[model samples]
Target: MHFLIIGGGFVGTALACELLKQAPAGSSITLANSGGPLGKGLAYGTQSPLHLLNVPAARMSWTDEQPDDFVNWLAGQGNTCDGAAFVPRQRYGDYLAVRLREHIAARPDVHWQQLQNRIDSLTPEAGRWIAQCAHGPALTADRVLLALGNFAPACPHPSLQALPADRYVGDPWQPDALSGLPADAPVALIGTGLTMLDLLISLQAMGHHGPVLAISRRGLLPKPHRENELPPPQWQAPAGWLAAGSLRSQLREVRQAIGRAQANGQDWRDVWVALRPRTTALWHRLDERARAQFLRHLLPFWDVHRHRAAPQALAVLRAAQAQGRVQAAAGRLLGARVDADGLVALQWRARGGQDTQEFKAARVFNCTGPSTRLAEGRRGLFGHLLHDGRLRPCPLGLGLEVGAGYALADAEGREQPGLFYVGPMLRSQHWEATAVPELRAHAKAAARAALGC
Candidate 1:
């Protein structure tokens, strides 16, 4: 089998490596990615040393069997860190790139090829997939894996169109997004999530002395992980909670479970850590209505607890807040425009009030997080696929709808033969799919399925 994996981020790289590791002698693999160096993707492409990983070093191995590979590699780099330390995110990106290169070098028996080009479109012909690239010859493979990771964050407001790029930043990950930004200019950020945390830290490292205002609907921020993570506990969700069926009922049970754990002298985080293995199963148990209810009402609270920050990372923001250099407001953005004072003026309303509130800043950024909508504006490859009836989007607009064994299903609910996916977008089917532990397993499974193993 010739496997064609698009998007050489973590998943694509990992999947290709796994294929080389296990596939038959005749099997070959090809990876095509237009993004930065293969394996960096959006998450790990950061050059900032301050951007520490949220997951500890011990749990970030590329393969399950060699669990200590990453820690051992770190030691070789002259960095001494225990299992619990959150190392720089770039190191992991470097690890992935090196691992992919090393695996390819070791497996001369199987053909390994790479195309550092953007995939323009994909089509099926003669029971195989053909991928057209932006600037290369079309390639063919027996299997295709849509490892397209997270897309760029969607613009928060439609009202502010055609503004100066430097004044209004749409995507925070762009290398030049913060370039030319003034050191003491007031700034406004749209979301108070993980992205915002990274931005705050980045700004501080750049010697930005400006006051920053972050706006989110509920003003919710990710809770910081405990200084020393609690050891995993042997625990399980009660049978009653699983059978609760209703979102509200299950949420109540979860709250009660945490309360009970706290009362029993167990950290609430222990209960959360225990639930990591079961979140997907629990998500599947909910009907569409219940899932929608969870998205609308409980998602923010869930996010705060589920996606946490490194304590040291959060400390920077806290220090800024104490110095009155940072503030978070629970509000909704109504509009934005450049004012006479050469600043961006933002109008918003508090979470539960009718009165409008205005905040002005010299620079404004939309850190509203990645757009869950797989196809926005119907302009890109995903949108093109959707328009062609080759893609089925989840009803909740979270991501593409996939089928058994991670096959990509079309709008008509027909699974595309030999097409698979492994990435953050798996969140459409598995609520807890975005992190490392889940993705590594998915990559392995996708490799197996692609190879007909």
Candidate 2:
């Protein structure tokens, strides 16, 4: 069997490793990426020492059976960290690269190759999937995995489009996006999430002392993980809460659980940890309207609590805010234009008010996170897939529609055989799919299913 894994990031690399362990002796695997080292992707590709993994070392292993693989590897490299330690993301990237190389060296019977190019299009032909790359010969495989990872940030607000290209940045992951900016020039960031935090840290490292502003609908920043490990909380769902089958009811139950935990002097985060295992199932139980309500009303609150920052990283961000180096506000961008003095003038309406205000900044960054709505201006290979009816958008528009065992589903709800996906986008089907623990399991399962096991 020959398997082609596109976008050789964390998901693709994990899937390849799983295939190596389970496929037949003569199986072949090809991992393709446009640039950067394998397995780094956007999240792990950062060179900044300030960029740290949100999760602790103990739970980052790619394989469940080897729970300590990452931490043990750290020790082998003369860096000792306990399972609870939050390490730099670059170290995790190095760990992934080393593990891939070692796996290839040990499995001499399996053919493994890496292609440093982008896949431009995919075509199904002759019972196999053919992937055409931008600068290489096409690859044909018995199966294909679309580990495309996160999408690039969408275009910024229409008003911001009038600004000079150099004055605005749409993608934060670009290596030089933050380079060459004036140290004293004011800057505005368009999102108040993890991406904004990353840019803030990078700017500080670059010695940028300019005033910074971050704007979002809610102005909510992610909470920090607890510094000390508490015993895992033991909690149970209220009787018949799941059976009630209402999103609002489920949320109320969760709030009640948190209240109970607080009353008992236990951290509310422990309740969230205890509830992790049931999140996907609970999401599936909701009807379409209830799902929509959750997204409209509760997603912001859930996101801040669920995807938290490392304690160290959060401390730095809070310190910056306390010192007035950074400012965050709840608002919506109205528009932007370059002024006579060469500064970009931004207009926005603060949340809960109708009046508009203006702010001048030398640079503006659109860090509003990845665009998940497939029907809205999707370009490149994914757009092609959707256009050709090979992939369907999820009902909630969070990502592509996927069926049982990670199979790609078409517009009419038919599963596309031999085509699979493993990424955070799987959140369309599994609400808790983005994190490492959930993603690693999906990779293993998808590989096993693809190999007919």
Candidate 3:
């Protein structure tokens, strides 16, 4: 058997390593990615030391069986850090790369290959999948896994279209996106999520002393991780709450749980942590309407609470806010244009205001998070798959639809055998799929399925 894994990010690398451990002798695996340090992806590729993992080192292992693997590895490198410490993301990336190399060295009987090229398309022919590369020879494999990580952030404000291309940045991950801008020039950012925090930290590291404006609908920032560990909550929702079968009821119950936990002198984070294990089951129980309502009304609030920032990073952001170097506003961008003086003019209305206000900045960045709608403006290999009717978007537009065993499903609800996916897109099926704790297991399961284990 031969396997082809695209998008050599953390997930792809983990999948390859798992296959190496489980596959039979003579089985081959090929991992392909556009040129970059494998396993880092955009999240861990940042050079700034300020970028820290939201998750603690203890829970971020390649596999669940060895929960302290990351911390053990850190200790081996002479870093005397505890399991609960939040370390730099680059360190984690280094760990992943080293783990991949170790697996490859230990399993010479299995053929391992790396292709540093982007896949342009995937065509099914002669009982195998043929992957066409953007700048290399095509390759065929018995199984293909689309491990594409997060997509680029979509431009949310239409007014940004009028601004000069040089003055507006649609993707913050691009190497040259921040180039040419003066350090002291005012800058505007679109979202107030983790991505926005990362950019702000990057700017601070670059010695940027200019005013920064961040605008979003609610302008809610992520909460900070707790400094001390609290006992995990043992409370469970009442059966009546679960039977309500509505998103509103579930939210009310969650709020009540937090209230109860607080009343008992327990941290609310403990309650949330206790609920994490059951999140997928609860999400699957919701009907389509209930799920849509949750997305529309509660997603932002849930995101900020569920996905928190490192305490150290959050302190920096709060310090910037206190110093007035950074400002966050709750509003929407009505429009933007380049002024006669080459400055960018932005017009926006507050959350509950009729009148629009204007602000000018030297540059603007779209950090509104990755686009979830899979079918809109499809590009590259994913676009080709959608165009060829091999893939279809989930009902909530979160990602592509998949069947049992991570098999890609088409619009007609037919699963495509020998084709799989293992990445953030699994969120459509499993709401709690993005973090390392969940993703590592997903990658392992997908690898087992691909290899017929």
At residue 43, candidate 3 shows an lDDT of: 75
| Residue 385, model 3, lDDT | 89
What tens-digit string does per-residue lDDT give for candidate 1 at 282-332? 888888888888899888999989999999999988999999999899998
After superposing candidate 2 on the true structure, give the runs of residues whose Cα lies further than 4 Å from its correct spot. Answer: 234-243
The models' CA-based lDDT, in order, is 0.85, 0.85, 0.86
What TM-score do all the candidates reach, one by one? 0.97, 0.96, 0.97
Model 1 lDDT, full chain set = 0.85
Deviation (Å) of 435 in candidate 3: 0.6
Q: After superposition, how far is residue 112 of candidate 1 from its true place, in Å?
A: 1.2
For residue 410, what is the lDDT in candidate 1? Answer: 92
| Per-residue lDDT of 26 in model 2 | 93
Q: What's every prediction's RMSD, in angstroms? A: 1.5, 1.5, 1.6
Q: Please, what are the lDDT tens digits per residue for candidate 3 over residues 1-453?
A: 888999878898889889989989998999998947888988788777789999889889988889999999999999869777889999988899999999999999999998899999998888899999998689999999988976888778777866788889999889988888899899999999998988998888888989999999998999888864333455655555445456777788788889997898767787688678878988889888888988998999999999988888888789899999999999978989999988998888999999999888999999899876787878998888889898878878888778878989876878998899988988888988789989999998898898887
Q: Write the per-residue lDDT of candidate 2 for residues 1-453, one digit (tens) a residue.
A: 899999877898898888887778998999988869998888889898789898999989978989999999999999998888899999999998888888888788999999998888889998898898889689999999988877878766877766777899888788778777988889999998888888888888888988888999898998888885435665555656446546777787889889998898878888788778888988888778888998998898898899888888877778889999888999988889999999999888999999999889999998888867788766777887888898888778788778888899988879999999889888888888788999999999998889999
- Output candidate 1 Cα RMSD: 1.5
